[model samples]
Target: MPSIMQRLNLRPIVLAPMAGGPGTPELAAAVSHAGGLGSLGAAYLTPAQILEAGAAVRRLTRGPFAVNLFAPQPSVQPTELEVEQATAELAPFHSDLGLPPPALTTQADIDFGAQLDAVLELRPAVLSFTFGRLTARQMEALRERGILVIGTATGLEEARQLEADGVDATVVQGGAAGGHRGGWLEDELADTLALTRAAAGSVRTPLIAAGGLMTAGDVRAVLEAGASLAQCGTAFLRATEAGTSAPYRAALAAAKAGDTVLTRAFSGRTARGLRNAVTEGIGQPLPYPFQNALTRPMRAAGAAAGRADVLSLWAGEGVAQGQEGSAAQILDGLWP
Candidate 1:
């Protein structure tokens, strides 16, 4: 049997699987080249794109690389009310871009089955999921193939659930993390959870702390609290090799001295990002892919025009703590 360390090569530091732009082939290869396990955030890619990136990484580095996906967020009703309310929330950007209102026909369109089939076919070294839990049959299929599975949990109950689902490890995403809060429980679903305590008290699977972790001390603090590793996404966002846009990299650096907030204006899921007009003034939109799609054109236009206000700009509450440097240098800081 492969030991846990042998399975993941037990890299104490892990590269965060950032979707959209940051998870480029160069970034993944560089992290793997640096001896840290790299992760390609294949969540947004079509199956073909995911396979292409994985094959490219294989050509560049002979090391462990994880493939991450947003484990199919729950579908929301695709109704006139949902669409009108959601698209109306996007009007400011539509006006700014001088374009007709987007005529969105459907709301939810995430193809989880296709993505899973891609995972099964590609068979990357590790497979990790976010957003929510996996079905028993899905978990069993991956296990049968010797694929190591990691689950994200935002709270105690979620962590326990991950353990029950047979995940080899659980990413203890702190409440302060960027992107989405994958907490499964109600009433207790605060926007976020603190990392250290969440790691120590809940699920026994090896814990990898996420959110607001910007420095080596931060990684150590989580490990001391019982985590086995630390996954730092925001810390690497501005790194030289990261796939973040010029505007985003610049904005992230500029926002480094400012505050971050959790808002659903970007993608319907509450993601932490810099404080901006779009986030603050907006009403709730269509959920998940609908909200994501509704804002896609705007996000594209904003980035093209260097307008940070309309872009997703997803980061943890610790945006102020983000460092500007190379991925290897960032890894050294986190690991050393």
Candidate 2:
């Protein structure tokens, strides 16, 4: 089966899926309505939530869209030793927030197999993954259901592996991309511009360049570098209909918000975000899920309290390039 890239007849632009509610059904549908592919970040949702989000997008438009999830990695539970290491680092933040030292049990147990089953049942037009590659069985199952599988890659070696693993295409993520990177190959993350073009140089699979992409010029450059399409995440965070919280929106708009910073304090894995204080308290971060879970309460409380400093505020270095508007308006700039 041809990949969704071939099937959709879409414009050479796609709104990349970002986890943590930023890529909502409304945002996805809006971008789809604007003639680019829309997507849902199902990594943080339950199977039912994924189904609901997918169904909502379907109701909004028949234009092809994408469903994205993180390939399940071994739950890296924080060792008591490691937890002590990170927690001590965060003691000051705890004091500032007027809270007790975070307990170690803070973790989420998302059922990955169930989520995959739900994804197959929903049968989205495109199935994409990040953080790591998908298993052969998982790829085959999605293919059998007529879903196009797209793997995320950080460099040329990963792109090569995705093709060898039988994925239909690759979302070539660069260092500039916000949220978790797809670099599984150690020391292989070359510069986004050079790596994305190089990854596509030898692969027959279509390439989708993602990262630090905001303006029409950036879009044109990626296409010129040989990407068949450009996938942008931070560009949509400021869209009016996006699920971005007010603090996140403001952070993106902040004059001081310069290039994105890479920190794992929020989720235990490195992700780019607008530089902020929460990331500054990174020394005490537990491992994935644990650090993510430990800080969940604080981030929620802080966001509800309108505290921008405590939020993850993920975005790329080109944050200064963000503009407040609708998806269509942003697409006008991206595709012009």
Which tens-of-lDDT digit does each residue in 4-118 have in candidate 1? 4566654577788999987787788778888887889988888998889999888988888889998865676668987787777677679978767865754347687788888
> How well does candidate 2 match the true structure in TM-score terms?
0.95
Worst 10 residues of 2 by lDDT: 1-10
Model 1, CA-based lDDT: 0.78
Model 2 spans > 4 angstroms off: 1-3, 187-189, 255-259
Query: TM-score of every model?
Result: 0.93, 0.95
CA lDDT, every model vs. true structure: 0.78, 0.82
Task: For model 1, name the residue pairs that clash.
Answer: 175-192, 175-193
Q: Once superposed on the true structure, which residue ranges of model 1 sit more than 4 Å away at CA? A: 187-195
Top candidate by lDDT:
2
User: Residues 151-191, candidate 2, lDDT per residue (tens digit)?
Assistant: 88887788888899888779888887878877777735456
